[model samples]
Target: MFPIRDHNPSGRTPFVTYALIAINMLVFLGYWGQFSAPGLDQFFYTWGLVPEQILSGRGGLTLITHMFLHGGWMHLLGNMLFLWIFGDNMEDAFGHLRYLGFYILCGLAAAALQIAGDPTSNGPMVGASGAIAGVLGGYLLLFPRAKVDVLLIFIVFFRIFAIQAWIVLGIWFGLQLMNGLGATQDGVAYLAHVGGFVAGAVLTFPALMRRGGVQFWRQTHGQPPHPQAKYRLAPSHIPRVPRK
Candidate 1:
């Protein structure tokens, strides 16, 4: 299942979220032209987080730079979509400047964990998934009851269902943990996802406590700080055939 959107709306404009999306897109477009050239791999190696390089104390800045680089179009789009949906509310909670700092910190934590997991791997890891997982964690803590629209595809059948944030994010983290334990490859950095999520939740705990801890949950009821949004799926318009 993939999240389409969320029912929770931010009280103020999420300019930082928008700016991040723009920058990521612009960076991707700038790098797309070099994909066909010989410099693409070199670019990734130089900018992307190579675990071995990081472990060797080389390319120290790659932990941050890797977030803006994506392996493919779908990778970029998927990461941006999650960020777009969940990031605004996070920025709303933390304010713009803090949210930006939080994002980079989470990404750094993610890279550090992934590097620790495979300190000798030479493959360069890239994408914003790790950082976005952090946003998911913060969202879960702040709005566990918020409704997120998830699209589920079952073979030929497809459906869009609204699920609570806790369930969705909990399941996501569980999967990441399971995969991180079961897999032993350089394909996906499941450890990064796990680390980023934990970092986001832990870092946001102080804020949650200042908001009255359990009292905040009682007041907001796990919804947005303002009001809960209502959603209705558009009616299916496929014409029915006349039966005999």
Candidate 2:
């Protein structure tokens, strides 16, 4: 299942979130399909976070640069979609600058954990999944009861369900931990995701306390502090067909 949107819209325009999406898109386009397989691997080695390179006291910049790189189209799209769905409310709560800082910090924490988990591995890690996992972490802490519409695909069947934020995020966090434990050269940085998520929640705790902690949840009923958005599906105009 994937979250498509949230009921709680930001009170103001989320400039930082929009800028992040645009930047990721533009950066992907800069290198998309422009290199051969060998060249692409070389590029990732240079820009992506490699545990060995980092431990060797080199390629320091990859920690930050890797967050902007993606392995493929699906990788980029999935991360961007999560960011778009959950990022606005975070930006609204933390404001632009703090939110950006939180994002980067989460990414750093993710990289650190991944490196610590397998320092000997030479594989390059790419994509914003780790950082986006941080956003999910913060979102869960602040708005556990907020309604999120998730799209569930079951083979040929598909459906949308409006689930509470806590349930969705809780399950996601659990999956990361479960997968991280059994992980063996799977090429997915489940540990990084776990680290990013925990860091996001921890960093967001201060803001939560300032808002009155449990009292804050009481005040807003564990939802966005501002008014929640209501949506209605438009009726389709396609003519119905009758079968004999």
Give the number of the best model, judged by TM-score: 2
Q: Give the winner by lDDT.
A: 2
* Tens-digit per-residue lDDT, 8-119, candidate 2: 8888799988998998899999999765546888898899999999999999999999999997889999999999999998898899999999999999999999999999
Worst 10 residues of 2 by lDDT: 231-240
lDDT of all predictions: 0.89, 0.90
Listed in order, each prediction's TM-score against the native is 0.91, 0.92
Clashes of each: 0, 0
lDDT of 2 at 5: 86
Error of 2 at 82 (Å): 0.5
Candidate 1 regions exceeding 4 Å error are: 184-186, 231-244
Per residue, candidate 1 scores C-alpha lDDT tens digits across 1-244 of: 7988998889879998999899899999998987899989989999999999987879988888999889889989999999999999999999999999999888988988888888888989999888888898888999999988888788987877788899989999999999998875658899999989999999889889989999999998887787666667732244679999
